[model samples]
Target: MSTESLGHNSVDARSNGLFGVYVHWPFCAAKCPYCDFNSHVHRGAFDEAHYVEAYAQELAHFAKHTQGRVVQSVFFGGGTPSLMDPRSVGGILDAIAKHWIVDPKAEITLEANPTSVEADRFRGYRAAGVNRVSLGVQSLREGPLAELGRKHTVDEAIAAVRLAQSIFPRTSFDLIYARPRQTLDEWQDELTEALWIAQGHLSLYQLTIEMGTRYYDLFRAGKLKMPDEDLSADFYEMTQEMTQKAGLPAYEISNHARPGQESRHNLIYWRYGEYVGVGPGAHGRLLINNQRHATATEKLPFEWEKRVHARGHGMVTDDVLTWEEEGDELLVMGLRLREGIDPARFAKLSGRKISDRQINELKAIGFVETLPNGFIRVTDKGWPVLDAVVADLAA
Candidate 1:
C-alpha cells in the first residue's frame, strides 16, 4: 500500500480499540428496481480519480479522533466497489495503514457485482488488502433476476462466485427470496443448488418493498403483484430450516455462516463497534472520548467533492448521542443478531441495566427467550414477528 495526504488533518489514535473504517464507492452499473441504497448509474462521465482523493481526505478527517484505535475491519461497500481502480483502493489502504494502527489481521471485505467488468477486479482487490469478497449474486435463477432488474446472467453469477472462491479463502454471496408466484419447491431447489456452490458464508434476504424504489411505485399503483404474507412466511421459515441443516446457520437476521466465518465487517455494525464512513451518503457510528457519535457525509458526488476540498470534510452531520438515542440505537441494532444483547455491553453504552420489565414482557409475548449463557436471543418462532417486537419494545 502507498501513502499520501489529500489534505492536512490531525490524528489522535488513543481513542479506543473499538474502531474500524468504511469507504463507499457510490456508482453501480445499474440500480436495481428494488434497491434503495445510495447508488446511481452514470450516462456520460465519472470523476473516479477525484472521487478517490475525496475519500482519503474524509478518512484523514476522522482518523485524528481514531488514532491507535485498532481498525477491526474495513468494508468497501457501495454502488459497486468493484468498479473502482485497483490502484485507487491500494492507495486508500496505504493511507489507512499510515494514519491508523490497522490490525494486521483486519477483516477487509469488498462488495462486488458479478459482471465481468467488476469480477475482473477481484485479484487486484486482494492485492490491495481486501481478503474477503461479498459478491451481489442476488439470484441463482434467471427469471427472478430479470424481475428484480439485475443485469447479470445466471451463468455469469456462477462463474463469478467460482472465481472469487479461487482468489480469496473467504467468500460470501447473497440471494433474494420470496418473489411473486415463486413456489416453495422452486426456491428449495435453488437453495440446494446454492449450497453446493457455497463456501464459508451466505446472506439470504426476504425481499421487502422499500418506499422510494421502483417496486414501491408500481406497488402503490397496484400494478405489481408480490407474494402474500402467508407465502412469504413459508419461504422465510424454509430458509432458516434449510440453511441450518447445511451447517451455515443464521448468525444475524439474514446472514449465515459456518463457525468463525461470520462477516467481520457486518459484525462491526451489528456489534455496535465504531467505523469511519467515506464516500457519497455513507453513514458511520463511532464513539470518541466517551461520547458516541453518528456521522454521515454529503450524499451528492459533486457536492461531497467540493465540500471535501474546502474544509477537508464532506460531513453532512456529526452528532453525539443522547441516552435515549443510545438506548434506541443499541436495542435496534442489538436485536438484529441471533445472540441478541449482552446485558453488560448494553450497560456500557447506556450506563443502566436493560429493563427486566421489558425483558419479561417480551418473553411473555414469545418474542425473545433468555439463554442459559446469560445472553438474550430472539426465538425462531419470533423471527417473522420481529418488527412488531422491536417497535413495541422501543415504544
Candidate 2:
C-alpha cells in the first residue's frame, strides 16, 4: 500500500497514517524582522487556563477524525512553544494520549529559542513528555545574530544548546546562511564551529527574501544588502562539503543529520504521508476509508479561543482534495525528499497513470530519472532549481 505519486491509501489503507498531531503555540518574545511565520509578541497577562483548555479541545476534535490509529509523533511548533508553561504542555499531551492511541515510542518534539529563560524549562518539558528538542539558534556570532534579529547571543546559544543536549539526547539546531554581506569563508568557519557542537542534526537554511517579511521590505527599500547569487551558491557548496565531512548528510534540501537521525515528523510531510495538524494556522492531510481530507485550524488566538469556549472546538477550514488537486499536492510535497516520487503511488492516488509526455519532457531537461520500478526522482542537477522543476511537473 506504499505510494509514490498520488499516495497509496489502501494499507491500514484506512489507517492512511492519519495519526500525527501538531500543536502550534503562537507567541514569541519578539518577532524577528526576517520572519514570516504566524507569530506575535505578548508578555502581559492572558488566559493561560483558557489557552490550555483550547489546546485540549483541539486534540479531542482530531481524536474523533482518527479513531483507532496510533499517533506516531506530536510536534509542538512555534512561536516558541518553550515560552509556554510546562504544565500546559503536559496537560495537552495527556489529553492526546487519553483521547488517542499513541505509538509506544512516539517522537514528541518541541521547538525552542536559545534564551536561558526557556532553557530553564527543559527538564520540566521532558517530564511533560517532550523527548526531542529543536533549538532556534539561528546564528552563533554576535553580529550575525543581531543582523538576524535573534534575542540570544553566541554564548547564550551555546549554553542553551548544551542544556538541551543535557536534557534530550536527540537535539538539533538551525543555522541561516546566505545572509546579506555574508562571505563563504565566514559561513565555512561558523558552520565548522557549529558542527563541532551539534548533537545529532543541523538545519541549515539559505536566507531568502520572502515577500511580506521585513527582510523583503528592507531589500526593496535598498536597505538590506546581501551577497550576490554567485556568492550565495558558493556558500551552499561550502555548506554541503563541510556537513558531509562532519557525517551529516542533507536528507532534505535544508535539513541534514547523521544517518537515521532525520526528523521523522517532518519526513511524514515531505514523504507525503498523512498527519493531523491542530492549533492556530496548523495544517494536515488525512485519508480515511478512501477519501482525502485537508485540514486547517483558526488563525488568530482570539477567534480560536472564542470557538473553543463556545462549542469546545476551534477550527477554520477543512476540505476534501479533488483528484487533480491531489495530483498537484503529491507532486509538490514528494519532491522534497531525496528518494523522489513513486509513479505507482501517483497512479494509485489519481487512479490513472502519469503521462509519458510530461515525464519525458522532465527527463529530457535532466530534471528527472526513473527507477527500474518506475519510481521517479529529481536528479542532482535538478536540486538547485527544484522550485521551477516542481512547477513544471505540476503544471
Candidate 3:
C-alpha cells in the first residue's frame, strides 16, 4: 500500500477521542500450564526477520484504516516480548512511527518473563524506546513457581524486577495469590514483601482454572486443591487492605498503582477507547465511519504471517457492533475502573438510559453506588459478584 493511501481519512465527530496500538508477539520459551493466552512454544528454527517484516506490513494495513490517530500508548504484549531481540522491538516501533503519529510521551510497554537471561536484555529494550516493562513474576516462592510451570526462581524474579526498575522509567510485576494450600498468614507475609518491593504498580490476580488449561484438567480430576469460596474472599479482602495501606490502591479489579502510576495502555481499554491490535490472535476496537467495529486476527502464528504476507493484514473477523452492543461493552469494561462509567456516555452510545429501578434496587442492596460525580461503579461488596451485577444492569 502506498503511504498516501494510508493517510487519514475524513475525521468522525463521534470518535472515542483516545487511540492506541497493541502488538501481540505470540511466541514463548515455555507455555505455563495455567495460561490460556494465545501463546505457542515453537520447536523449529524461527525467522525473526520475516516475522518483523510481517508485523510492519500488518501495521501499515491498520494505519490505512486508522490514520491521523495519535498513538498515546503502544503495548508489546506476548507470549514473552522479552524473548524478542531489541532490534526487532525497535523495528516494530519504527514501523509504528512511520505509519502513525506517535506521541512523544507515549507509554511503550513490553511484557517479559523475569528470568535472568531475559533480564540481561533490559538495557537493550530501554535503548530501543521501551519506557515501561511489565514482568511475569507469577510467584515469589520456588514451589509455586514450579507448580505454575514458570522457569524462573524467586531470586531471579526479584533480581529481574530490580534490574528492570534501574533500566526502565516505569516497571510493574505480577503475582498470583490464593494458590492451593496457601494460608492467609502466608499470603499476608508474601504481599507485605511484594508491597515493599513494588516501585509504583502491581498486578495481583487470584488463580482461576480456565477450561483447556492443564490446571483445569487437574482441577476437574480432583488433583488440584483450590481455595474455597470463603477463603478466596478472605484472600481478596486482605489483598485490598494491604495494597491500600501500602499506598498502591486498586485502580481496577486486578491492578493496583500509586497516584498517576496506572498503566495508560490498559486504561485505554478500561475506558473503552479505540485501539488497533496487530498480530496473531489480537483483538481491536476501532471507530470507523462513525461506527465501532470489533476486529480479530487469525490465531495461529504462522497462518497469521501467511495471511499478512498475502493480504497485507491478518484480520479474520471485522464486525460492526450495534449501539446496544457498544453500550454493553462500555459497561463491562468501564465498570472495572475505580472512576466508574459515565451514564451520559452510556446513553449516548446505547441510545437508552439505565433503568432507575434497577439502580435503586442495586444501591439498596449495596451492590453498586452512584458517585457524587454522577458515575456508577461497583462497590466493594459488588466486586465479588461483579458479573452478576453487570448482568442485572444490562438486563
Candidate 4:
C-alpha cells in the first residue's frame, strides 16, 4: 500500500470500509487531576510479562469471531501506553499479525507522554513496528503545564516531539485550550509555536470538566473557573483560523491535520467501521451475524486479565444494536467529521430519512449545509452547539 493517499481525505461515508484494532494500556506513571480515563498508577512493580501474555490471549479470542478481516489500523491508547516496554508492544503487534491479516501499510500508533524518560524509548518503539506516535503535550507553557499536573516541561515536550519526528514515520501532539484563565493572545502565541514545530497532525482540545475528575470537584467547590462560553468560543474560532492558515485544517471537531495526514485509527471510529477493543475499560464495535454489536470490557486491569484468562475474552457487554440505534450512532459519529454524514447511508441504516424539517431549519439558520455529494455537515455556527444539532436531526 502506498502512503501518499492514506490521509488525503476523510473516509468516504458510503465507501472506504475500514477495520481496526485498539489496545488499551491502563497504567499511567501518575494520574492527572483532570483525567477520568480508566488509568491506574501502580506504586509497586506490576506483572508486565503476565499482561503481555493476557493481551495475546484476548487477541486470539477476538480473531475467532473476526476471521479473514484485514486490519487497516491499530492504536495503543491508554493511561500511558508508552510506559509499557517496547518489547511488550512488539509482542502485542506480533500477536495481532498472527491472527489477522494486518495491512502492510497499516497505521500503527502508540500514545506517549513527552517526559525525557519515555522519549528515550522512541527508537525501540520504532523498531517494534510503531510507525506513528501521538504525544501528550497538553501545554507549551510552564504555568499551564504545572496547573495541568503534567510532569514534562515544555522544553522536554518539544524535544520529545522532535525526537519522535526523527525516529517515527509520523508524529502528532496534543494541546489543551480554553483552560482556566487562559487568554486569547496567550493561546494564539502558544498555538503559533506549536504549528511551527508540528509535522502534519495536531489535536487541540477544549478543556471540559468531567464528572469524577478532580477538576470537577474543584469547579464545584468554586476553586477553579473554566473559560466562559463566549470566551471559549472565541478560542475555538482562533484555533480554526490559525491552524487553517498554517495548512492544517480541522478534519474533526478537535483534530487538525494536513490533507491526508489524519489519524486513521480515529477515522475508523468516526466512520463507524468495525474494530476490536482489547484491554481494560476498552470499548469495541463489531459486525457479527449481520448486526453491529457494541462491546465493552471490565475496567479494572487485573480483573480484565483474569477474565481474559478464564473466559478467553473479557467482554462484559455485547449488545446487538437495532437499526434505529445504528442510525443515531452513525449520525453522531459521521457529523463530527468535516466530510459530514451521508444522508442516503443514514436512511439506509435507519429505514427512514433525517427530518427535512430539521435540515431546512438548520440550513436556513446557517448552522448546517449540504455538500454537493449530498452529505450534511455542521457549520462553524453549529459546531459549538453540535450536540443540539445532532439531537434535532436524530429526533
- List lDDT for all candidates, in order: 0.83, 0.82, 0.92, 0.91
Error of 1 at 196 (Å): 1.1
How far out, in Å, is residue 305 in model 2?
0.7
Model 4 segments beyond 4 Å from truth? 1-16
Q: After superposing candidate 2, which stretches have Cα over 4 Å from the reference?
A: 1-18, 372-374
* TM-score, cand. 3 vs. native: 0.97
State which candidate, 2 or 3, has the greater TM-score: 3
Best by lDDT: 3
TM-score of predicted structure 1: 0.94
Q: Write the per-residue lDDT of candidate 4 for residues 120-178, one digit (tens) a residue.
A: 99999999999999999999999999999999999999999999999998889999999
* Residue lDDT tens for model 1, 1-395: 01142222233231224567888888888889889998878777766777788778878887766655677888889888898898899988887888888888889888999987788888898898889999899889988899888889999999999999999979999999887678999999999999889989999998888999998998899988888988988998999999999999999989999999999888877777778888889898766656667889888877888999887888888887886677677778778899887776666666677778877898997889887888877788887887776666666
Model 4, C-alpha of 121: deviation from truth (Å) = 0.5
Choose 1 or 2, whichever is better by lDDT. Answer: 1
In the range 195-245, model 2's lDDT, one tens digit per residue, is 999968999999888888889999999999988867877887788778888
TM-score of each candidate structure, all chains considered together: 0.94, 0.93, 0.97, 0.96
Candidate numbers sorted by TM-score from highest down: 3, 4, 1, 2
**lDDT-better candidate, 1 vs 4:** 4
Model 1 pairs in collision: 11-64, 12-64, 13-67, 13-68
Judge candidate 1 at residue 270 and give its lDDT.
76
Please give the lDDT score at residue 122 for candidate 1: 87
